[model samples]
Target chain A: MSETAAPLAAPLFDRVAIVGVGLIGSSLARALTHYGVARQVVCADRSPEHCAKAMELGIVERATTDLAEALEGADLVVLATPVGAFAEVGEQLGPLLRPGMIVTDVGSVKQAVLRDVGPHIPDGVHLIPGHPVAGTEHSGPEAGFATLFQGRWCIVTPPPGANEGAVDKVVTMWRRIGSTVELMDANHHDRVLAITSHLPHLIAYTIVGTASDLEDDTKSEVIKFSAGGFRDFTRIAASDPVMWRDVFLNNREAVLEILQRFTEDLTALQRAIRWGEGEQLQDHFTKTRAIRRGIIDAKQA
Target chain B: MSETAAPLAAPLFDRVAIVGVGLIGSSLARALTHYGVARQVVCADRSPEHCAKAMELGIVERATTDLAEALEGADLVVLATPVGAFAEVGEQLGPLLRPGMIVTDVGSVKQAVLRDVGPHIPDGVHLIPGHPVAGTEHSGPEAGFATLFQGRWCIVTPPPGANEGAVDKVVTMWRRIGSTVELMDANHHDRVLAITSHLPHLIAYTIVGTASDLEDDTKSEVIKFSAGGFRDFTRIAASDPVMWRDVFLNNREAVLEILQRFTEDLTALQRAIRWGEGEQLQDHFTKTRAIRRGIIDAKQA
Candidate 1:
């Protein structure tokens, strides 16, 4: 059935406060408006320029630097800032939240969200941490689009014994915004993301780093010839610096764990090459090809 | 000046033979026809179906399975087959080559080409090994297009003491086909490609393999959630299996050398992650970002 065929119930929340007006935050605001998922959308950004631009773009009904002012009269509040700022934002919003209100976030790292944002969510104020598992290399308010979440996965991790209604409402909101919602524990979410996103970003950044360190002439040639394999790494490395910094800081455990495994595998492959073990190299390559096929069969490729 | 501004003084060869009508071979055939670089383009492939399709698609003037027959009367012969088959094809074509004939190839690994085919080249024949650093994920005759080489580098590694005129003519042909030509020793070309191309492919294949070994449910989720990072690996892994196998087999030395460096770097990153070395991770990531910027500045990103 078409997504819009869902019963046209009254807007889920009276006012939705989006705390941050960057790419992910702004995209959420746009999708919420496009789907009429909330009665009103207000935004809070540390950057006054971003707040002004978001308001000018008409993505949110109101934009402000005052977090409490934006949260006033809002039934749903989304902490859309970088993970590094979540604890402070959570503490600031905690005092202002009413009994029936719900709090959540769209951060890349989930366990850190629970640890940082959970304490500030007062009793009877439900908290559902979520990650939409989607984005482009671009950032900022202007980079967001209404369909940013379309056909993507939105993972929600509500603490045990938390309000089911609150989780369902958040899931429904993501569905309205054209996302498939999956419920996962926050720790599991961190591990999965470490492999699927964090490690990839790290490797891309490293290879690009290696290239950057080359001498001027060689470096220029590296870029000129980047279309071979390096271009893809460049795209991944182009992601928002502050946001990624926060991700690494928050999800330290899982990212590190998977990174260890990746390193071991990489080392083994290296030895095979150094030792001129053609069979080992070919065997590994052949095995990897099967994984690619699996991904294609799953419609991911 | 427009590429078509200059007309050829005369045809370089009466008939140009291309053995193996895959993406690269068929593409060369198309470019030869489009630019009138050759008098007639003849193709041969081990797959009868490919030969038939090449003829049906009009990618070449004639298609055949008999390598010796295809080499007849051809002043220029291009070995478009995988690197693994070069020795066999070289031996067959060596005796049939008339004086003043030029034999070149479109292979990824240059040193291997010299090792396998250099000895077979008769005294009067010229052997210029070229690699056009361009391709899509697709393969086979039907996947060929004339513009594949446009704005791409085509490295020509002519053996030392080889005919300078022959090298010039091969370079001219590549330039006319819309490729930027660079001359380097075959060994150096192999080393550069090992870092830029071969090692990246190996890593991609390995990571995808690791994902494939995950539990069934996790594997499915991986594919579903692949867009975040895994999609790029899938594209690389989907490349022609036989061609890649041949590449690994032929360029064993250089590919192995670079693979070692990549592994060492990967291991260091892994240890940092396992030990929660956030600063080290951040430093590496920051360094990599500079490379990405370099690529962009060079217009390769």
Candidate 2:
């Protein structure tokens, strides 16, 4: 018992199987290995190219297309695929998850993970859903880096009555890889991220879509002058399309709720602009500065 | 005349007067002096604090709160104040202009600048309105840098039948300070910026306002987890409130037009999310990525 307790204190997973090898998955594999959080980090991606790239990039010790093959001997499994793929992946993944193994995910929307992956988890296999609130516009295995999770917040949504040791181990891995972990309820996590991530991405996508449909000459000028502010939206809008789509679909209620609030607020400002309400516009704009200050103070900026 | 040719070839402004002495104003002063584009740089601001900072930073050879005092012996003048102040400042500025002096602006909206400042221009004085499609969220004189305009586009909209030599001098100044000059009409410049700059800013401000209004608990979490995407919007929304407020009031028509289109697009996306149209959302998201690629390829990213 003491010998077993000693290994648990180190919080090292003997094997970690990351199923995706895309940006987040590949980055996690790199971080787990680079930080010595796992004895071995293997990945299974549906795309052969991603598997090849993962191995070439040396982010994972071994990369394969076979999910079962990757799961063999793994004590921890991480689903890094888009949320839309979770149900199918979990259907196959549940049977393969060993009783003592821990299954977690890196999807942006959390409640959907619980809804999609919860039933598949074997009774003894612990399930924890998480979102590492960090990313770049770039994607795929080659874009992954060992320090991708450094100084970011990783929110974990563990099932009610789940194994405490399993939850602690998952949190430990994230912290070890340079993430701050926050334990949260899946529903609350989805709601928080809806405002923080989903709504922002949806707005970015909408504005960019509108800009792209402009006349050819106007379009070129728009691209040329984008540095003013549009460039930032473009970068955010350029994030993984499938991933973002899944996020909006899975987090529909919370996203739609926040977006409805956003539209109402936008309409008020629009009316103010049309009516030449300068002071009103100024007051509203001034209020937002405090939020940015809070973010900077929180060191998230 | 041949002796004056040497100075003209240098593309230098002698005794330049910059109004406002804020972010864009101070940055222009720094660039003018740092790149030897101006023989002497002086600035005037309504706030004496900004003038003091401008002089303390050595960004200008002279700084004063008196616009008339700053314009003495100046061959060139730049109206860097917010567009809302253009008419009032132009009234004060028009009488101070000399016959040979060329006046330009670094305002975001060009047509409004032309309208507000154009009527006040004395005969033989060139009024070439310009917009350097660049800035940070930071404001005030001290938040500026010499290279703020470097590798950026400075769109100049010279009035019809404008003085060729004066236009050339303004264009040359922008080029010498490391901006690529695009000669555009004021109407077109305003329309283009309506989408690229104004609408994006309005959306950012609105979203940040919405997020800021969330219940205090969720508001704190939003800021803490903002790195996902909200942080970018906050940075943009953190821009000077008065300046942005003035922009919306001045560029009302163009901004409202683009904003109408943006709202329609956002509604379509909202409907798509409601109906769980994954493919539609994915396609829309994918198309926006092309615009980002265009921006990157154009090196405006």
Candidate 3:
């Protein structure tokens, strides 16, 4: 490993293990190599084909199906698999983790991370759960690029009494790869994400599903004339199915809570439309427009 | 007016009058000028400032508040106002239209166009209602550009037995301005748009409305973390309020119909989430994924 780390410079991990070489994992590998954030990235995947592809694409220094082998010498282990796999991966990696090693993850649902992966971490090992609020509709190793995380927010939910040095190390690595890291509690992160990410995705999937159930001709026409607003839902609905499925399953309570509110709001809007209440419809639409402006002002739009 | 009209080339009208100088209308004027689709473009707006802005921005050759003056000597009158104003605009322009003139509109809802404007056309004149399935979230003359309609679909719903010459003129003009025009009945257009555009916008507005009602601190956090999925809805909700309000009001029947289906589907998903039916959620989400692929294949995503 390179040893000339300055006070503010990013410290290179001797070996970094990235579990599940999908879009997020492969993207982290690419960014680490591109920025020299780590000396070596070693990836392990359950699918041998994905491991072969990762090695062939040169996204990592080494690729293997043996999780223990991949984590043998790694100072930083990032579990980039779907949240549903966190418990199993954590159990597998727990016995192999070395003292002073940092364990992080890129899971959308944060509370699940603490619940699933927290208990398995050994003493002296840091557990920093992160959610990089960035992605595209595409998935897999081939779909990832080094610039995927640039100018995006990465929320880190480090456990209480966690090692500050380890958290700062993970933050520095993310910063080196061009992400703004923000710290928040896992529960708050889950709730905020339920509204902003999970609920929106669920609604998009539902709308697109409704459209898909239409007659063939009408469905074709919907696809043809999607430039209106349905196309946006289609894009969001196309995101990685496994990841989203795991998201809904893991973050069930928060998702169900927000979805209940969405349903009530939609039902009210539906009644207003049916009764031709133009004033009410216009009022709600106009109020929503203000929130949109605030998002643009916040530079997140 | 320039008289160098080739059989299939050159200006389709001596003068084209646009009733509103917002994004769609201004973009149409700019495109007409850029492609020489009309010899002169005249604009009228309820706001005197908008008219002046349109003229200053060179989106129209002439601007006026008097709908009568704007329609003077114009062989083609385009009612580019909100759908809610079609009836009033139609009534105002009915007596001013010259014989054999073509009256059209760029509104999202088509049935309302027929219901409001169909009776206003004078003998020997034609009403060819159309909607260009394209636009950004921005509004006003300054937000428009000459190439806004390039490669987009424009649906024209000409009345049965309408003047063939007028239909051809509108089709030729749209083609020259970089739109692929498709002819369909007005009622069918409304039904198709209800599913594709109106319902999606209504849902987006409702979801964003839900987010807006969050507590002040949570609302601010939602805006900051909006890049996840809420950002897309914010952009959609940021669309012109008056225009969308008009859409929901004008296309009440079909909007309510499609909205009913969407709400039912959302309820099913909500129930699935509440019951922790992972398979049900996965099945629906997976099915929706294909529709997105179809949209991308159709080049609309």
Best by TM-score: 3
Window of ten residues with lowest summed lDDT in model 2 chain A = A1-10
TM-score of 3: 0.95
* TM-score of the second chain of model 1 compared to its true counterpart: 0.96
* Leading candidate by lDDT: 2
Which residue runs of candidate 1 sit more than 4 Å off their true CA positions? A1-10, A56-58, B1-12, B47-49, B249-253
Interface RMSD of 1: 2.3
TM-score of candidate 1 to 2 decimals: 0.91
Q: Which tens-of-lDDT digit does each residue in A133-222 have in candidate 2?
A: 888999888888878898999999987898999899999889888899999999999999898888989999999999999999999989
Using alpha carbons, what is the TM-score of model 2? 0.94
lDDT of 3 by residue, B73-103 (tens): 9988998888999988888888898788888
How high is the DockQ of candidate 1? Answer: 0.50
TM-score of each: 0.91, 0.94, 0.95
- Model 3, position B170, has a per-residue lDDT of 87
Steric clashes per prediction? 1, 0, 0
Cα lDDT for residue A16, candidate 2: 92
The count of backbone overlaps in candidate 2 is: 0
Please report, in order, the local distance difference test score of every candidate based on alpha carbons.
0.81, 0.90, 0.88
- Where does candidate 3 clash, by residue pair? none
